[model samples]
Target chain A: MAETAVAVHAPGAGEIARKRPYIPVFVILAVVTGIELAITQPGLPEIEHSLRIIVLVILSTIKASLVIAYYMHLRYEPRWLALIPLAGLALVAVLVTALTATVAHP
Target chain B: MAHPDSVDEGGEEHHGSPWPVVIAVGMGIGYVGIVSASIPILVVGAAVFAAGAGGWVHVDMERPSRAFYGLAAAIESRFPRVSARKLALWLFLVTEIMFFSAIIGASWTLRLRTTTPGAAFQAPWARPGEILNVLLTGANTFILICSSVTMVEALAAIERGDQRKVRYFLLATLLLGITFLSIQAFEYQKLYFGDGLTFTQVPAHASEVNKLYGPTFYAQTGVHGSHVTAGVLALAYVTRKAFKGGFTKDNHEAVELVGLYWHFVDVVWIFLFTIVYLI
Candidate 1:
């Protein structure tokens, strides 16, 4: 009887496994893009130049994270797989640093 | 030939093919042409590459099941279950990260140096939203994001062995990708001819903007647009295969692999939209 019951439960398990939070993620992405467009429009509270830049950077980062973690299925993949891109980002960091230094002094 | 060596009863290893070599050689030639700035040499390389690619795609579509499927299945049994193709693609993506970094970093450096007071360049970067069709590009960004969702769903559908849904979703993804490229082409046309942003020029109204702006904008977004064009071609290939009932639940690595590339493009655009448009 237990074996038969286990067989009966197996079909439902497949459904549970395939479920992913895709639509909610899309909603969040669209909403964020809307906010990005809104915040950059011509007439608003004159945000400090630096603060506006910071906010845009942060928002873009959040949007990027959502797409990578969800759309790319990186969240579900092995954690070590992320190290590949991070390796390239390590170089990017150096480039950004060098560029900033040049800009500050040049 | 279904010879014993190529066909393991267990279907494990692939003595892959030589066509990829031809493709690589063509790309190598193209790279050389780029360095030399010779249009004829570049065109020849591109033609050869296209032929090689077309032949490879033809072979895959004709016999997608036997060699590729067995290889994918054999390699998927190991840790993480990613096929060798997927691993190779991820590695390729890493290189793309560095490539984009170079383009974007150089552009940003140029912008900064030009705009800085007492700097060498004559003018600043045009202000945000000044010379760009931000609203149109923003809509294009949304289109790309939507395509990403459709692409993921196509993979999901294939995983479920729903061939109809796979075909539908792939077709949807292909259409969305084409829409993106069309909008980009339109934007390029407008920016170049209508708005006076060409290789060595900017709008007269924005005469204070640096001359480097046009080249940098085209370089960053042009490379990205080319990537999207490649993605669309990939999508078309897979969509054709999916329509032919080529992928089943147990053997759809092509779908997944294409999804990986598509999503990677979306990820790049996510940042590109911010860096180029909003910032």
Candidate 2:
């Protein structure tokens, strides 16, 4: 009776019990961070400045997405809940665009 | 009538408190004070905010950290449901996303405008590792990432009713969070005093760097450090409660909420380490 009550009130409790790739995600984040440091080091074969920036941004985005998807459990959550952060990102896109325009023109 | 804090059929407590409103009022006043540059008003706002936080903590300290899903169920029967607190937390995170964006956006704008030629403050930006300690901050980033793993592991432990593992993981996470903050504090001290990176001036070593560099660097990393401090405090609270057995397998939403916040902070640092340090 108690178990049924809990299951009714708390949906997805079982799904959360399933094992996740916490260690693997951590390894990816750490490795990517190391790559970021390596690429930016002064003695490394000088990558073009613009290319470095693009690569760093892509790498950081990957790290952020992994953290959000696994550590924050957005991947396991209801699809709609993911929309909350995406909505914020949409606004961020707008802001970045505006800021980019300002910098390009001025 | 049933007492307002009475338990329902599912053994969930139902109650309302005024502390959230008080906190909001305090924050509203604090925002006003900031805009107007009123010191006394700001102090008053801080006092109110502190009081509200203290009162809420005191009220909740003895209660088991439980989920309130009654309203969620009644409101939505067709769609998949989440706990009210979790939904609210995600919404709060959305606002945080916008908040950090604005801060980063403004800093980037300043950097672009001042560093470009024929601009009002045309000065060169500092090269990577010229004025800052990227190596030290990179290590701190690793510490934060470790904390995120422990935080999730803690949640996973509690979900399995492994009370001992939950306590141990929470303790480990708390220690890792404290270490991250300590490293950041050390970095800030060294940067501010040893390197002369003040709000108004660049490091003496990097004299040719734009004056705005100091302010922008501190603003971005300092704001992030402040968020980490808040995360540490939240972790401390949850850790204390977990030690007191204030959570159970079915009623550990607080752990998940705090984990979400901790990971969010970690996610922010991933970008910040790249943007502020590596780039």
Candidate 3:
């Protein structure tokens, strides 16, 4: 009699056909980077310094999120795994707040 | 075909390896050497670290990489089943997140303090493109983003058991990583020697800039450049292993793990380009 074996199944051709949109993500990343470069051009119309900073930060954050989600496969992982990075971000928040507070009041 | 190396219901047996402990000991000694500023001790520590790393790689290269799920079958059912190695890698990445945050945060603080009005060191910060070559670095940034794409595609290819595509994609990623580093090295040389952007001094043309500008810029970007170098080395290893047929459709966790690190580095550059270059 053959013994029953438990194994992780590799994805089949059908599953492979349903690949994640890595190319689309790459295109988005490249486009956003281009936008970032365009807005920060030396000869461009002068945006407010603070406003330019805000726009750049938002754009970069979007790019970073896309890479993390699709390229790093975080979006496909179990939900709990995200909590690990979220915990790290929480510490970063505290650190940033403290640093800003110190600079403000010093 | 079912995976030949799958764990049985009783749980897989794990062999202990001493290389990791050796690596840790070597790093600890290296840290002590740095703290004490002793060249001889540092050299010794580095030698030991290299030996440990070589041993680990040699050992690992001999066999196809295996995924180890640490918990027993019954307990594993109670929790989401993640490979033990992958869990450890995620935990390591979290520490990396904190590490980079501290470095960038300190640089920002220095920038804020020195550039503020009525502060002792009241020189203004350099506007965008005043000193550094934004166009060149922007192109380098694109190269890094391309590498990230190839990295993911490599993992995707291996998951489908397409060995040829895996080799090609991994080679592309490794080349792209090398290109990114080469561009960075060229930029660093040009900035430091041609443009006078040393750690202690700014370019003569930028006399009104804060003295801290050079230090902060180098501190933030230098550490990031070092990380890219490390990532390139890791990419080379994985590329070679892929060519050697060390990984399979089911045993390509190393590819995925390295891709995670590579993408993380690209993510860091996304923000770094904004913070250090654009802003």
What TM-score would every model get versus the actual structure? 0.90, 0.93, 0.93
- Name the docking class for model 3: medium
- TM-score of predicted chain B, candidate 1: 0.90
Instruction: Write down the worst ten-residue block by lDDT for model 3 chain B.
Output: B1-10
Per-residue CA lDDT of candidate 1, range A1-103, in tens?
A: 2223223323342253278777788889899999888888889766777787888888878888887887777787666678777887898899899889977
In terms of lDDT, model 3 sits at 0.83
lDDT of 1 at A98: 88
User: Which ranges in model 1 have alpha carbons more than 4 Å from their true place?
Assistant: A1-17, B1-6, B65-81
Error of 2 at B190 (Å): 1.1
Using TM-score as the measure, name the better of candidate 1 and candidate 2: 2
| lDDT string, candidate 3, B156-181, tens digits | 88888889988999999999999998
Q: What docking tier does model 2 reach?
A: medium
True contacts kept of each: 0.51, 0.69, 0.62
Worst 10 residues of 2 chain A by lDDT: A1-10
**Which pairs, if any, clash in model 3?**
none
Question: What DockQ do you compute for every candidate structure?
Answer: 0.35, 0.61, 0.53
Per-residue lDDT over B1-279 for candidate 2, one digit per residue giving the tens place of the 0 to 100 score = 223474567555656778888998999889889999999889989999989988887677677776665555665656577777888888999899998999989998998899888999699988899988888888888899999998998998888777898899999999999999899899989889988999998877789999998888889988998999999888888988898888888878899999999999898888888888877
Summarize candidate 1's per-residue lDDT along B68-177 as a digit string, tens digits. 32233454445344444666788899889888888998988888777777877658777679999888999999999899889988877866678999999999999999
By lDDT, is 2 or 3 better? Answer: 2
What lDDT tens digits, residue by residue, belong to model 3 across residues A1-106?
Answer: 0111114424462275357898999899999999999998977899999999999999999999999888888888768778888998999999999999999998
- The predicted structure with the larger DockQ, 1 or 2, is 2
